[model samples]
Target: MKKVIPYIASNFKKDKIWMRRTKPSKRQYQVVFAIDNSESMIDNNSGELACEALCLITKALSLLEVGEISVVSFGEKTELLHPLDKPFSDNIGGSILSQLAFKDKQTDVSGMVSFVVQMLSHSRNQSINFSENLQIVFVISDGRFSNREEIRKFIIEAYSQQQLFVFLIIDHPKNSNSILQLQTISYPNGKLTCSPYLDNFPFPYYIILREIKSIPEILADALRQWMEMISSSFL
Candidate 1:
């Protein structure tokens, strides 16, 4: 049992007040990053950056109390760099992230969707109550889909889970259209754009999920802002 249920009764005794149970269970965040390593993301070292940034984020997320991080890299193949069953800890997060190997084949977004959907489903089933377990799925891609309809179907199904929050990456026009029907997460305007060159991109403060070939300190900022927005709802 976590927290005192609101509006509960407090009884007055001879000299003491009897109160309801107030044991609090900590709210934990399980963040999963699914990065695209498909052939399409090879340009400008995007594939390499995907893995690197994921590692950085994983390390950062471990700083939070009761935070767990898992990563899945997909090309034509989907590989689980970090297992979802394991909880993230500061000492081991980096080692787990470094194991994210990639395959250079055509991008199969539908396959990625299916793999993550299954993984999340399995993870959810582990806990009977999901209210204290927040599952955040970050799908970062160049926005190329071999089967849009199939991916769309899986995305909607995943959204039905109260704890899952799916954030799709936007880099091309095609990426924009894929998310038109999917509004599972309330993103800052339902759009996420990445500039090839962050310097050329205006107003760095507004950036979310920027495609930085070189790591940016702003990524930490973006994550903090994101964490703040979802804290009231989940935490």
Candidate 2:
């Protein structure tokens, strides 16, 4: 005996391109950005730089007509700075960027992951019209995780449910070697690395370091590149 799969589309009548019976539904995409706010982030102008980067990214996203975005920051605890359900507006971006609060405490990576998972799950359940196309999670951190195994497990769990994209931002030069080591072990398929500290070399390291003071353009470009990559892959 052969089994048959039901064709729901067959139940509906076909229409022409210009003369359509049913109106096309709009597709909505949601992207969530998760930033790390550990004590280490406060050192070496990272906190300030991160704030600028976040402001730029959110500002850019506000201009895009594709989907909605939510921003979350985590240190010893996690907090939803912007709700995903809210409209992408200049006011929302300004409100989120204005809260440049950084904690001089440890970051709980696992806890942050748990918070994100819960948010995604809740959103998925509550959403009446949701797309399963792209769910992005960008993580910016300077140091390697103390709870490496737990973080890995959380990533795995997240991946099991939705597509995961991690953007690890290394802000400190002192943790360069450690960052490389962590990237080697923690990141799968070599998808993570340190943010470039130098734009042009052979001039002066201090010049490059000073230029790093402005992170808004850097992060905005990085996110734009990532989105372009995703679009290209789809094409």
Candidate 3:
């Protein structure tokens, strides 16, 4: 009987049965916001709207077990407003809004996208189970940007890596060529796929936002919809 007890104890220890624990199957998501802070954003108060939108997004994510978030602003240069290293907070969102300066004339969309892609890529590479994580990017802009080809290349790369890129173009009731150019760059075939009555383009990712007042509702809806899609994929 003593020999039998010792044998069972040794087998259990070898298998490490006591170390087993259940891990939740819920998917984790990493979100990044690339906000445009160019001079044009000052015209319709879009910069402030962008900041409010960020607050709404962070608030929504706080309700879920979503992973960390990062915020980047682009104008004359791309800058990291909120880094992923720090946890998200409403106070942080307020701080980001206070720092917004719409003085730059250039919106380097490509540079901003490149930086986000690299940041998320590095994070994924360091993870042991990266496949369980999803990368999502929300680009809020007035659509006046430079480097069309470069932006398209980075967008394609992000999509190829299974990252979700949602482009929210703030259209302030103008027949602006800059907005049209940005639409073309974002479209897969280099052509506009939306119309006046349409909010979403042929692709599910691109959306045209018209009202600054409805920023919170619109962003919350988009985030919820995308999260649903991501969750469904796991089943």
lDDT per model, in order? Answer: 0.54, 0.56, 0.68
Q: Candidate 1: where is the Cα deviation over 4 Å? A: 1-25, 87-103, 163-235
Model 1: lDDT of residue 148: 48
lDDT string, candidate 3, 17-38, tens digits = 3234435445557888888888
The pairs that clash in candidate 1 are: none
List where candidate 2 sits over 4 angstroms from the true fold. 1-27, 131-133, 173-235
**Better by lDDT, candidate 3 or 2:** 3
TM-score of 2: 0.64
Root-mean-square deviation of Cα positions for candidate 2 versus the true structure, in angstroms: 13.3
Error of 1 at 67 (Å): 1.8
TM-score-based ranking = 3, 2, 1
Q: Can you write out model 1's per-residue Cα lDDT over 1-235, one digit (the tens) per residue?
A: 0111111111111222223333344665677888877666654234555655565555445532335678787787888877866776655655654554444667776777678778877776787666667676777665545454576677667656634444434343344333232333223576864433323221112333434432344554444565565565445
lDDT of 2 by residue, 24-128 (tens): 225445677777776676774566656655554555445434466888888888889888878878787777756646663777778888888778867877777
Clashes of 3: 0
**Alpha-carbon shift of residue 193 in model 3 (angstroms):** 17
Error of 2 at 102 (Å): 1.5
Q: In model 1, what lDDT does residue 184 have?
A: 32
Best-fitting candidate, measured by TM-score?
3
What is the clash count of model 1?
A: 0
